[model samples]
Target: MTLTFDGTVLVPVADPDDGERTAAALAPLLTDRSTAVLVNVVEKAGGAPDKASVEQREEYAEEIFERARGPLEATDAAVETEIRYGTDVVDEIFAEARDRDVDAVVFTAREGSRFAELLTGSVARRLVKEAAVPVVALPHGDD
Candidate 1:
C-alpha cells in the first residue's frame, strides 16, 4: 500500500517530549500538501470535578501546541493546534481523525507497567486497533 500523509494528519501529544519526537518522526511522511493538527486531550472525570479549571487546562494545551508546532512550522506542512476535553482519550482522538479526514495519526510509543496499562489502558494500542486511519507509533526508549 502506498502510504501518504498528504492530507490532514493528527499528532496526539501525550508526554512533554512527545511533541518533538512525533514531529521528527512525521517529517519523512509529510509533504507540501500535508496539514498537521497537533492535538492534546485533557482527560476529564466521568462525574467528579476537575482539579484544574477549563481555562487553566486550555492555557496549558496552548503551550503544548506551541512547542509541538515549532518543527512543523519550518517545514511545508500546514500546522493547527487543538485542545479536547473528554473522558475517553482514544475516542476523542479517533473522532478528530475521522471528522478531519486525517491521512494518518502519529504518536510516540509509551512503555508502561501492566498495572498502569490495566488502569488507564494503552492509548496507542487501542488507537492502532480501532482507528480507521493509519497509526504511526514511534518507539521510545526507557527514560
Candidate 2:
C-alpha cells in the first residue's frame, strides 16, 4: 500500500545519527500540512538501577531532536519533539503514537547484526507487528 504523510506522524529516534537518517528519509514524503512529532524513548530500568540519569537522557534526547529537526524543518512539514520514559522501548513508542493520535509511526530501521537483534528483540520488528496505527519503515538515506 502507498504511504502518505498527511496527518500527524510519530517518529521514534534512537540517537543523533538515527534522528538525522530517519528525518532525511522522511523529509521527501512530508508536505506543508504534515506534522512530524519526533520522539525519543528513554528506557527505564523499572525496579532496577538505571544505566543513566534521567537528566542525562533528557539532554541526549534534546541532541537527537536537534539533529532530526534540520532535515524535517527544511521540508514544509511542522516539527515537534517529545521525550518519553518507559521500561520497554517499543511499548513507549506505541503509547506515544496512540496518545498523540498519530496517523502513523515513521522511522528508519537501525543497522545491527541479526544475532544482536534476536538477543535484544528488535524494536523495528515489534513495531511493525504490534502497532495500532500504521507503521512506516523508511529506507535510510545511506541505504
Q: Which candidate should be chosen as best, given TM-score against the real structure?
A: 2
Candidate 1 residue lDDT tens string, 1-143: 65558888889997557776677667666789999899999999889998889998888887777777766767887888878889999999988898888878888776679899899788878998997888887554333
Clash pairs (backbone) in predicted model 2: none
Q: Compared to the true structure, candidate 2 yields what TM-score?
A: 0.96
Q: Rate the local accuracy (lDDT) of all candidates.
A: 0.81, 0.92
Clashes of 2: 0
Candidate 1 displacement at residue 27 in angstroms: 2.2
lDDT of 2 by residue, 9-48 (tens): 9999999999999999999898889999999999999999
List the lowest-lDDT window of 10 residues for candidate 1.
134-143
Model 2 spans > 4 angstroms off: 1-3
